[model samples]
Target chain A: MAVLTFLLRFLPFLLFGRKERPSPVLDSLNKLLPSAIIAVLVVYCLKDMNFRRIDNFVPELIAVAVVALLHLWRRNNLISIGGGAVVYMLLVQLVF
Target chain B: MKAELRYAVRQTLPVMIGYLFFGTAFGLMLQNIGYNFLWAMLASLVIYAGSMQFVLVSLLAGAFNLPAVILMTLTINSRHFFYGLPFLKKFREMGKAYLYMVFSLTDETYALLCSVWIPDHLDGKKVRFFIALFNHLYWITGSTLGALGGALLNIDLKGIEFTMTALFIVIFIEQWISATKITRVPAVVGLLCGLVLRLILGPDRFILPALIVTVTILLVLRPSLDRRSGEKEEEGSSVPSKR
Candidate 1:
């Protein structure tokens, strides 16, 4: 697992290390892919939700909503994540 | 060097807090699953990727399946492949520390490196190295402490895993808020692809397919995207300095 993870990190440099300039296609990807991949990660984190049950999904939805709204208001990482996680813990521990 | 170190520390303070909490949570989880502090230290020291390390805990607890481990590592850490792209030229300039730089480019470190403003008097490379090193040290310390805490102090943290999800959402919002016109396309593409694939393929198998599809679509749309961004570059608004 460690070797594979390192190899993935090393792959880009190995491919483009010697090139004087990356191709237009590669450059475009460099410019565009970061935000896209990050958005995908957000979705990936929520993949296990079984929407058929309200209890299983409601807490997550409320928590995510809190994270988003708090982030938008304060624009602070610590506040957004910390606030959302606390709300989640409360909901899971007591409400649902 | 002193000035650079001080600046790096100040810049990485937020990451320090985040890593400490997140790492402790990871340590607590691993310990709960019967792994000792040694394992937590080793994983944090080597893997260095926060989310992947969490996944690693589960993998280690389960019956060892090499193929499953390989695939999970590839997909989970694949984002690191892109993280290195913008830094390739800069990292290459760092000489022997280049390998270490690549290995330590976790999401928080990458974001800091991309967005932080180094002072004009300080060497950018040195500051970057310090930032990376400090972040890694915090993670190692946090996880080791968490593992020890788990062994010594029993506490209920039932919903603590939600931190991982919350972190991702924070990152997604950061990216979205900072995205320019040309970059917004891929963000939308990723979300739609991820959601569609998740609904169709189910959660367990959706990520890889979503990534492949997103990449293919982006590649096909590259020309127009390139042209749009090029125009923005001409207007001198290319890179937005984000915090």
Candidate 2:
């Protein structure tokens, strides 16, 4: 499993060497992909969102808002994440 | 060298926070499933991918089929292949540290390494090396600690996984804000495509297909997108290239 994980991570580097620049198309894709991937990942994290229960919705919204607003306000990764997670834990444990 | 290592350690502080929680969760889960601390440490050291390691707990509990395990590993880690694209040049120049970089390229480390700024006095290679090394150590230490004492700690951690989610949300916002108009296209497309696929295919099956569709959309939109964003490409470089 480890070897497989390493190979998957290392394949692109192995395929594209240091001496050569990737083609123009790939170069463009390289720039484009990070934003796309990160966006997709956000959705991936929220993939299990359950909309049937209005009760379940409030905490998620509040937690996500806390995370976004805290990040915007502080721009400190730790503050934003730690704040969000604490609020989320409190909500899920006590309120919701 | 000490200063550079300190800088690396400081930069990885957020990841250290996330990894400890994540690794502890993994350790506790593995312990629940009848694994020992040695097993958790082994998995953390070897199959160090965070999400995949979590998935691995269940896989280990299930019937051991090698082919099934290999396929599962590939699918879970397919996103990693794209990560190395931006780092290809830099990794190739890292001397002996190149292999370690490749070996430890977890999601959090990749984000940190991508955005790391090397001071003029510090060696860039060493900074990157230490960042990767420190994050790796944190992960191993967290999992080992969790395995050794997770049951004793025994606090409710229901929504703690939100740490990872929150991290991703911040990263997405950063990308969205920094992205150029044309560059934002892919980000929007990814979110829309992923949502639609998730609705249609349901959550579990959406990711791979969503990724494929997003890439295809980007390819089709490349010419116009490139023309619009062309000038800013050099200015707003996505990944810091080899210097």
Candidate 3:
């Protein structure tokens, strides 16, 4: 799962990761391999997703949402995340 | 080399606290469910998802049939697709280690690696590899320990799964602090979708759908968001002036 995820996350940078002025080693790898791995990952993700009835897991969902809002307001700062985490921790433990 | 590894470990210390305890719980849960260290390690290393590991304990115990496992895997991991999309190139040339590196990529590690300072003086991929390696170790080690604890004691792990929520919050905080409007946009979408999805799809299926929705929204806005994130990354990664 993580491997597929790595490929999925990293591959699209193929088009966008390129810089007119490139970092040779990094640039070459970016051009060549990311795509192959991404293909494999896509298969993996699809395979797992193809079947099954999904359930609702609320606490984490809410946490993701709150964090997203906080990210917008605070710009991914750790302190702000701290606030977000504290809220999530409380909510998950207490509310839902 | 060891010193660099040490530094990496130190940097991940705060996260370690959460990983360690959560790992212990996960380990214990799986152990109680008839899994051992090998199983624990495989789950942590292969799946590499903290929440999934705990949920997997039940799944592995035959809690659900094949269909349930499939649905759960997809739903739990949907967000990862986009997370990896941006870093594909880096993982490609990572050589033999690339496979292992990819196997261990998690939301926390990805966020940390994405924002890491690309050292001007040395091998960037190697540096990134170490970062990935470092986080992986934390997880691998944490899982081994968790399984050990579960083996020793008997307790219902259903409630303990909440650790993942806390962990996500921590990761969310870490990203939120360093993120900008562009990065935050996906997160915001995750939030809104997560909320609505939770209500509609319920908690279990919310993440994947929310991820799809968020990614689509981000894709639509990519040009503008990329322009913004690119600017921020420039400002964020540039060297500070030496006094």
Candidate 4:
């Protein structure tokens, strides 16, 4: 597992690091992929939920909405994440 | 060096909080599954990838299947392959620290390195190295403490895993707020690809396909994206071109 994980992380550096200039496609990816990948990751994190069930979905939806709104309002990472997680915990523990 | 470390600490404060909570949860989970602190430390030391480590606890608990383990590791961590792209040149410039940077580039660490700013007076390489190192240290400490304290500590953390989700959401919003017209295209592409593929393939099988489709779409759209970015640069917009 360790070897494979290292190899995956190392592959791009090994392929591109030594090049004087990488292909323009890669350069474009460097710009484009981060935002895209981050978006994918947000979905990935939520992927396993059984959204058909209200108990499973509502708290997550509300918490995620809280995170988005808090982040937009404050633009503070910690506040948004911490606030959302707290809301999630409370919803699961108390309300939902 | 001291100033760089200080800046790295401040910059990584959010990650520090998140990792400690998240890592401790992982450690507790592993301990519940009968792994000791040594195992937790070792996993955090080598495997280092956050979500995959959680997946590993299940893999270890179940019947040991090498093929399953290998496949899971590759699939879960495959997103890492793209992470090195932006840092390839900058990390190579860091000499001996390059490998460490690559090894420690977990999702949060990579996001921090990409988004944070270093002071003009500070050595960007050293600051980046410290950021990577500090995040790694936080994970190790959190997991180790969790493993060691698992039996004694019995707080309800049922929904705390949402922290990871919340963190990613915050990052997505950050990127959205900062993204230019062309940059936003890939994000929408990724979200749509991920959503559509998740619907088609279900959750377990969507990530790799979403990534491939997103990349292909981006490539097909690259000429237009590149041209627009070039025009933006010519207009002297503050957005830094990736190259």
Top-DockQ candidate index: 4
The window of 10 residues in a row where model 3 chain B has the poorest summed lDDT is B156-165
List model 1 lDDT by residue over B1-243, tens digit each: 999999899777667767887889889899999988998999999988888898888888899998888888887777677678878788999998999999998877876776666779999999999999999999999899999985565666678767667877877787778778677899899999999999999977787788789889999998888887787776676455531
User: Candidate 2 docking category?
Assistant: medium
**Every model's DockQ:** 0.63, 0.75, 0.13, 0.79
Instruction: Summarize candidate 2's per-residue lDDT along A1-96 as a digit string, tens digits.
Output: 899999988888777754476788888887888778777877888888889976576888898999999988988878888899899889888887
How far residue A39's Cα lies from its native spot in candidate 2, in Å, is: 0.6
TM-score of each: 0.81, 0.89, 0.61, 0.91
* Predicted structure 1: lDDT: 0.84
Q: Give the clashing residue pairs of candidate 4, or none.
A: none
Instruction: Tell me how large the interface RMSD of candidate 2 is.
Output: 1.5
Location of the lowest summed lDDT over 10 successive residues in candidate 2 chain B? B234-243
In candidate 1, position A36 carries an lDDT of 75
Consecutive 10-residue window with the lowest summed lDDT within model 1 chain A = A30-39
Q: Which ranges in model 1 have alpha carbons more than 4 Å from their true place?
A: B1-18, B25-35, B50-72, B75-79, B111-127, B231-243
Model 2: residues with Cα > 4 Å off, grouped in runs? B117-122, B231-243
DockQ of model 4, rounded to 2 decimals: 0.79
Report the candidate with higher TM-score, 1 versus 3: 1
